[model samples]
Target chain A: MIRIENLSKSFTLHNQSGVVIPVMAGAHLAVQPGECVALTGQSGSGKSTLMRMIYGNYLAAGGSIMVGDVDVAKASPREIIRLRRETLGYVSQFLRVVPRVPTRTVVAEPLLALGIPSDQAHARAEHLLEQLNIPQRLWSLSPTTFSGGEQQRVNIARGFAHDYPALLLDEPTASLDAKNREVVLSLIEAAKARGAAIVGIFHDEAARDRVCDRTVDVTGFTPQRAA
Target chain B: MTQDQPLLSVRDLAKMYGGRIGCTDVSFDLWPGEVLGIVGESGSGKSTLLGCLSGQLAADRGQILYRGRDTRQMSEPERRLLSRTEWAFVHQNPRDGLRMGVSAGGNVGERLMAVGARHYGDIRETATDWLGRVEISAERIDDRPRQFSGGMQQRLQIARNLVTSPKLVFMDEPTGGLDVSVQARLLDLLRGLVRDMGLSVIIVTHDLAVARLLADRLMVMKDGHVIEHGLTDQVLDDPQAAYTQLLVSSVLQV
Candidate 1:
């Protein structure tokens, strides 16, 4: 469902004396629908930068990223935003719940962002939460009270609730214990079974082994390394 | 069961806020050059115990003794300096353990700088040495944490803590965000470092397997207290506490 060719990213760096040094270089990746791929590499291997390119968080310096016929690399800002909203989903390594937002509201925020009516959005979110077995008692409560595992579940619920055709998750199972990790993995599998194209950046080896059909080694893919 | 003064000691430690509980009647003495793994479910108060031991939070009751010195009796600045120079904590989120926007070198050297190391070249050299030891390339020294991978960021966190060579180290799920292979590598690195340095460590984790791998002794906590504590093999091989049994069985492969 997605195609990327010759994708490259770089940033200019400044030295101790304020001299600029350019870092990052041409990187490439391609992900298919109904498939899970694991990106493995050491730090500064450009794994995250590659994900950012696909997620449209960073503008690629060169090459093309096409998702279902839309050229994400060349798409206008509005077009990219729409594509991100309607066609793609992302779960960050850090759970990015807007502090102070209720769990129910955080779950429903995307639906509202998609311009669904408030009532309809709330109903959809509530229904999904019920299906996911989120307790009704905590529906209006902020996610801060929930533990890391609970917060991860909420993150998964939000990412998949929208039913986007393609999903991109960056290390979704990092915070979970073994049991909860299994649950989240099963959920991801269920999403794939429902025909959602999924690409995940993973750190947990067990999670990666369970969810991914293929692995892409990031070593030698880039020159970035922690000093 | 009291022996010669332990490096750190906790007795009947209880912390409660309002109706909420942190830990209850928690007691443990950490000996020199031993690794203690604290295992628990989320909200099991493992983190709170770490906070109490590190003096990040004052115990509502009970005494924390560091080499016979009552931590509660120490003045704020005294405790602060002790916590800074003699003890180190590695939090779950590397971001919490580090200044995210700072360069890797800066993150690794900050502790030294705080302890009054003023030579930029000396700090940079030390940072480089630690990074290399942690398997991080020196080229990325100037890059911000944002530019590193999750595993790299975690290693940077470790480098930062270990560079100070603190007598006692507290790690809360150091590999919580790493992949299996990376976790293995990091665990190996940590094990080796602890052995070579004879560093005392308390690692809090929910992963019983992880506990088995690194800890000489294991303590399983549920709710707010340690339900079981023993040698790692004894605890995992024959858990006396039902909670520990459940936890051990849950993570073991059939």
Candidate 2:
């Protein structure tokens, strides 16, 4: 369901006299439906860069990132948004929710964006929160003020609330306790069973081994050592 | 109309004032039930872009297609009718959009009347319902907007515009000039209403926070040019252009 070809990326340092730095070159990958692929690389390697390119956060130097029928690299802003809303989902390491929005609403937002009824969406959010061990009392509060671990768990809940056809997960099980990590790993397994194609960055080797069908090392994609 | 077709399509739209550019080469599509945000510093042509889209200002170049037909080709009365029915414009200053001399009920009732609702009782009843929706009390129906607080006036203006259930709405700083708490409340109400009503909105704001909260897609303008455009979270989180990066940094410069 997700495929990328001839992908390359470079960063232009405009403040430093417009110096363009080539990062990744000639990268390619594909993930079929019901498969989970892990992106693995050393620090500063193009692991996150490739992931960002797939998510369309970084404009590609040249390539096609096909998530379903839409080429994320070439899709217009609106098309990318539509693809994100209905086809693909991403869970970044950091939680970036609007301040003061209740955690329930934040978690339920994706389903709501799809025109799902509020009661149904909220129930699904609550179920995910409960599965991840978040306290019921905190459901009405904003996730911003939660602890780092709590915030990460909330982020995971939001990402998993919708059954997106394709998903990009960044360190989803990072910094979690053993029990919560198992919960997340099983969530990944369940997603795969339900036919989702997932690409993720996993630092936890055990979690990576347990959930990912294969690991694509990003070191080969880098053209030069990142400075 | 097909469900996937964009409700509004803007192509190479440009506007100029004698020797100066208002907005130039602006283009984007707004899908049904989508929210697009234009953000920039003052005089960056965000407001000019908004005015041209809402039919308040004529563009010097390009087409604004509302559901496949170019709106610029429409006659005056036809465009007026469209504005009164399918389109609504919310000004930065509520006073500019409101009928200050009229009662709150009359202000909202006027929009329904414009759409051919002639029965006085039904108009007043719908007007009262909309006032309640915007959190204005029914008893205040007869009070002129001149007496309402800034926040209340803005809410009443919203009721007036939305009472017609316009499919597409253009908002220029809908929360400008309100207190922080009041702005939050207004945004809350707006968010709920937009979702419930499936509104297609084009909002211009200098407040990145507001844009983040309400916008699905974002276009960053600088010196009358669109420097960057992307999903709201993507643009705000990892802005690529130099101008957008500077703007994002300043927002986080607490």
Candidate 3:
């Protein structure tokens, strides 16, 4: 299970003459295991920021984010690494991998980080990459050279490589074609079947309908100052 | 040679340092735009195999054919020209790949100059463009590599090696010395560039994560011998070799 309570985060822009920008304030949400929650909001409504906060990429100014028993907001860097390794998974809009690395390795990385053996990790990554329909020929090339759709598939594969307890997905299917989108939807179903808690941002209503069990409107939790 | 022939081929290649073996009976074929990874623990001879294949170290026996020509038969100047114009090597350390005293733009521009690129303005413009492509700001073009962070230096080194648009690249642990976040970002940038340019690459690393992510095919080496070779997925998912299985399981236990 994952829970966020009175979560507030703001960024001070030093480049903009030290002006403070409130991203999220007093936002509260809970995602139970086996449930998928979609974050809905307009552009700049802090949907991505909220996701990053949950992933411990952004520090919250106040409040709490609890994933399983660890409070993400208060967790140390080491604790966060362990949580990411064993429990939390994230699929960002863009795929990040070492230069000159092949797709199979990129997909298998998260598992390897969790101390999964190379062969097993490779097997899982290969399955996910195949599921996403990334061509075997392109698997040896760098994702940097991949098309937007292909890169997203690699990103999705990395995220789903492990059976994480909690997952955060940012537009997992944004660049995907219909066939690939269907694959992602099925993967999400499988994750939920295993009782993983999920929070995602889905601009496509059809995709949202397919996987999201509920919706949370970010605008409702917008910081008062920003509002 | 047929049009479908491999871009590079190695057969029964062997190397030795005095009485000690470096690598023996290695063989493989690399298609254009394909990425092949060689993996093993330290002293496993993966590095020696890479050195022999890249022509940095001479092989004691067997053959290496590049674009249908035997590399051993090529003149010294011819080999130098090939290294400068058609091939690139990315070292594990950024310092090895980059010239710290020179400006970033100069580092990239020099590669172009080596390949007979003239027109000073054109060189500078291309350097700046490559910097941007590698996710480095153009504003840092004049800064020396010493002034850059480790991640930035690695990115700059990539931009330098890639500015000439070499058809083949060899990388040795390109991400071995960086924070996790920085490594991820660098990998992303590298992937995009290789894909965009349709480069053929050979990479050496002990880190299976890197092999899994980048190599199309993989060769597993142990004690100067090739233990396993197959599609990256096959070698990793269902390794047939006992050594490879142990390597896979040991990484997991770590």
Candidate 4:
């Protein structure tokens, strides 16, 4: 389960006369096990900010963001890294490729981190890549030079390779073809069925309706409106 | 030791040389099977940090806890025993770590002997196996390191250090003196060995590409200060510090 209470954030511009920009305020949300909540908002409404705060990517100004019992906002970097390795998974839109690392290794890295045998991990990664429609020939090659769609597929494969208890997916279906989109939707459905608590940003209305259990409009948490 | 505790825990570690800062207030935990790369320019004190951690140089301040035991607090002989058994260091120059006058087999077998392998045949077989693993042939085992190429000597040095299966390895610019192709081959061999053996490594390198290839986490040093430390890919790709950004950007494309 994931929980957030009294969450707020602000950005300070150190340069240009030291301006402070309050982004979100008094945000509260809770997600149960096996539930998928989609964040809905226009640009700049703090949807990504909220997700990043939950994942401990953005340090929250105030509030507790809990994935299970540990508060991500208060956790040390070591705790956060451990939490990411074991309990939580994030699938961003982009694949940050380390040049010369094979695509199979990249996709299998999550499972490998969990101490699964490399051969078994690679097998699961290959399965996910196949399901995501990446070519077999590309498995041995690195994903750095791949096309946008190919890289996205590789990212998805890496994300779903491990059965993480909680997940934050940023545009999981973005830049996918129709067939791949269908595959991604089914992956989300499968994750939900397997009791994963998910927070996702889906711009596609149909996909949101199909996979997300409910929608939380981040517009309600904007700092100016809250003030 | 607790199951979740870090393999190596360093707190407020610092070393200085006559009012000149070597590395100051460097703190981090190296988890089991993790590779932590210390990267900076020529005088950044990355090598200084390595020397202090590997027990080759004594630190002026702070504590280094290896598996719940403070290394600095240990007696000299105990620390030496730990160094010979559970710890290994690979130098940038192979001559620094390898006994150039000794045969390649003898260089590796000496580590086994240090760890109490009295049987000659067994030590020789293990030395030969390790030599082959590092891609040096059996025939070269009897030859002195002076007869080997730079890369072969480096490989022989790796065989010497790893023959004991040290729990933690300290490598300072392990590929610094090698050509590009040789460096690539050595990196590949190291990667495979690291994964297969689950070795915990503290590697200090000026090469970002080397850090990118080998390290799980990275600490970017500047003027003896740790300016940035994070996951290697995160630090490299989305570098927050201006110094780290410059360091990453300055890598040549060719």
Cand. 3 TM to true fold? 0.57
Ranking by DockQ: 2, 4, 3, 1
DockQ of each: 0.01, 0.39, 0.07, 0.15
Error of 4 at A118 (Å): 3.2
Cα lDDT of model 3 by residue, A1-227, tens digit: 99999998776543446567777778999999999999998998989888887877666789999999999888754456568879999999976556667789888878766557879989998888888898888877778888888888899999999999999999988978889989999999999999999999999999999899999999988877733
lDDT, candidates in the order shown: 0.78, 0.91, 0.86, 0.89
TM-score (C-alpha) between model 2 and the true structure = 0.91
lDDT of 1 by residue, B132-194 (tens): 999999999999998988888888898998888888899989989788768866886786578
List the pairs of residues colliding in candidate 2: none
Give iRMSD, candidate 1.
26.1
Q: Which candidate comes out best when scored by TM-score?
A: 2
TM-score of 1: 0.52
Residue lDDT tens for model 4, B1-254: 55477999999999999999999999999887788999999999999999889888899999999998999899999999999999999999999999999999999999999989999999999999999999999998899999999999999989999999988999999999898878977987887788778799999999988898888788999999999987776677646677887787789976
Identify the runs in model 2 with alpha carbons over 4 angstroms from their true place.
A225-227, B136-147, B237-240
lDDT of 2 by residue, B46-133 (tens): 9999999988999999999999999999999999999999999988899999999999999999999999999999999999999999
